[model samples]
Target: MKNLVALLLLSLLYLHGTTSLAEDINSDAETLPAFCTSYKCPRYQLIKKYEKFEHRIYNATNWVTTSLKLDFLGIGLAKSFKRLLDYINGKNSEGLVMKMTVPVRIKVPRSDILSTNATMSFFVPPAVDTLPTPLNPDIYVEQLPEISVYVRSFGGYALNSDYEKQAKILVEELEALELSYNSSYGTAAGYNDPLTFFNRHNEVWYMAL
Candidate 1:
């Protein structure tokens, strides 16, 4: 009788452990970054990881972008986001409401003197063949070739200054490695909802020359 009681207790403990582990896995899946769940986002393989940088090879991707030629980065981004959101909300010629993707990318020129114009882009999902024509003339679609890039990632809310600082760090690391990269252009990628307060993912990407 004692042995049977012992066996029963062990079974109960085993079931409890399994249940807890399953719950933990479900919680983790629910908390995955938006970038990982989006099929439209660029696919990349991590080639190298450094203390402050990562080298990656990214596959070719299609994008829908809007150009905002404003002096301030924040203002330009705001306008671009508004325009792009409208496109995704069915403000297009086909009146199609596109799926929202993660890691909204912004490209900036790489001059010491800041440029007035910047391009903000969203990834086009694979199933979207009949591309919607943007009602706004400033928005357009383009297919980009596969490229290799070095990236620096950071947490929390991303501001222009944060991106600039991280980009500088990546450049220094690349120099240390004797790597050549395109200095004329770079991209900033954001991978979190606006309301996310912690563990936010932001990255600055520089193309390999």
Candidate 2:
């Protein structure tokens, strides 16, 4: 099912054009730093760059997300991604089929090694006039407020270990610089499809305090 969903998303990408699904978003691509590979990404400003991390301010945007507790990151992400994908694939109150977005966001709270409270999210396109209610009980539309974050970017494919390693490095760098951040939680964002094999973009984020 995941593979099928990914194929469908790729098809959507081809049909809408690789860069954008809307003209308004395409106009701003040159002006702002794009975090996602294709389609529209959440609007953000690059505030500053540090030796090991970057500081950014992002505007609030709505997302379709699903809560999942990780017993294993791979399995958990698969489940959550599927649920969110289904929601955007005409499995909603209004049966909407929207363009796929990049940089899937996963929020995680600090906790045990194997298990943590986490939720996976996909950016909601501004083109969506009235966001449809999710048919799946586990999925919901959420709005994130504008916020500041300390971010670290890395290349290649990311898994549980990759994100954890990046987060550790990010935290260490922040503490060394005497930066203030919420130690309780952070997020990881991936800007590629599962089929994307090279030049994959990934980042771990720590919310600034």
lDDT of 1 by residue, 76-165 (tens): 456677787778767899877765665677777775223555677887755566678889998998888888888888776766567777
* Candidate 2 residue-wise lDDT, 1-209, digit = tens: 00101112222233333332333423333433444655677778889999888999988888998886565325565677778777776789987777677667877677544444567788886667678999999998997799998999987766666777888899899999899999877787777765667777788888999
User: Runs in model 2 with CA error above 4 Å?
Assistant: 1-35, 114-116
Give me the candidate number with maximum TM-score. Answer: 2
What is the C-alpha RMSD, rounded to one decimal, of candidate 2? 6.0
Candidate 1 residue 94 Cα shift, in angstroms, is: 1.8
TM-score of 1: 0.77
**TM-scores for candidates 1 onward, in order:** 0.77, 0.81
Checking candidate 1 for backbone clashes, the offending pairs are none
